[model samples]
Target: MKLLTVLFIGLIMMGPSDPTFKVGEVAPDIALPNMNGEIVKLSSLRGQMVFIDFWASWCKPCRKENPQIVADYMKYKDEEFENGTGFTVYSISLDKKKEAWQKAISKDSLIWTTNVSDLMGWKNEAALRYKIGSLPMSYLIDGDGVIVAVNPRGDKLEKALKKNRKSESWFKSLFGY
Candidate 1:
């Protein structure tokens, strides 16, 4: 009975095994296969703001959200962030099949050059590292790889991006860009 009581207390004090990051925290780097079957590290785009999206081709809601993502990408691709010069999307697909992943990207007009996957579906390395428990989960990270928003979409995503970036007035005030 004393052993059982001690074990119970120890278990209660152990805390969660998986550490979760909230906004203002630096996101852990991820490395996986890009579209060309080449390994692409997430840290490669460190100087630019990146939206890391975890999605799968088979998920309808993810597919439906693709258009909005594409729109957001196009709109913010060339924008100047607070500490970054450019913005890009780092799409991580939870697809076990390469064909489906590539097909979905082409079909959705996802023009970003950083689409990547492990082709491991739910067992995707990056997805697991990011602790993705659902389809279409995402993180908007700053130039320094700090998470600014989680699961931001549509107008909400736009607002987050807008607020974080430097305005023309800000540039003019600071001796122009």
Candidate 2:
């Protein structure tokens, strides 16, 4: 009885571990196979901004956010915006079934982005390492591989991009116009 009480007390005292990456910290390199069976390494995209999105097919919020992500990607994928920043979205699905994952990707029209899944559900090693307690979480990584923001909403993302655009305009005005 005493040992059990002590064990319970110890467990209660221990707090949950923080996620693997944090804002301002360099994100760890990850190599995962995309939907096409192509392996993509995070380090290979060193000089571009990346959005590492953790989501699942069964997650309602993730589904709702898909369109917004698609729109943002479409807008920014073309050319280096005013701030000379190029964007890429790397979507990591937590689905355990291939059919559901593939179906969601098609339904949302998530084209031109890297989609990957281990089909391991919550047991996915990356998910566990990232300490994902919720779906639709994302990290904005800068060119240097440092995490710029975590779980930024659509509005916030737009605001950040807008600021970059404004800066670019100012640069153009000073130089050319």
The top-ranked prediction according to lDDT is: 1
| TM-score against truth, every candidate | 0.83, 0.78
lDDT of 1 by residue, 89-173 (tens): 8999988899999999999998988999989987998877777666667788888998888777657788778877878438656
Off by over 4 Å in 1: 1-19, 168-177
Q: Best candidate per TM-score, number? A: 1
Local accuracy of candidate 2 as per-residue lDDT tens digits, 36-79: 77888777777677788888888777788889888888887654
Mark the 10 consecutive residues where model 1 has the least summed lDDT. 10-19
What are the runs in model 2 whose C-alpha is more than 4 Å off? 1-20, 79-84, 164-177
Residue clash pairs of candidate 1:
none
- Displacement of residue 147 (Cα, Å) in model 1 is 0.7
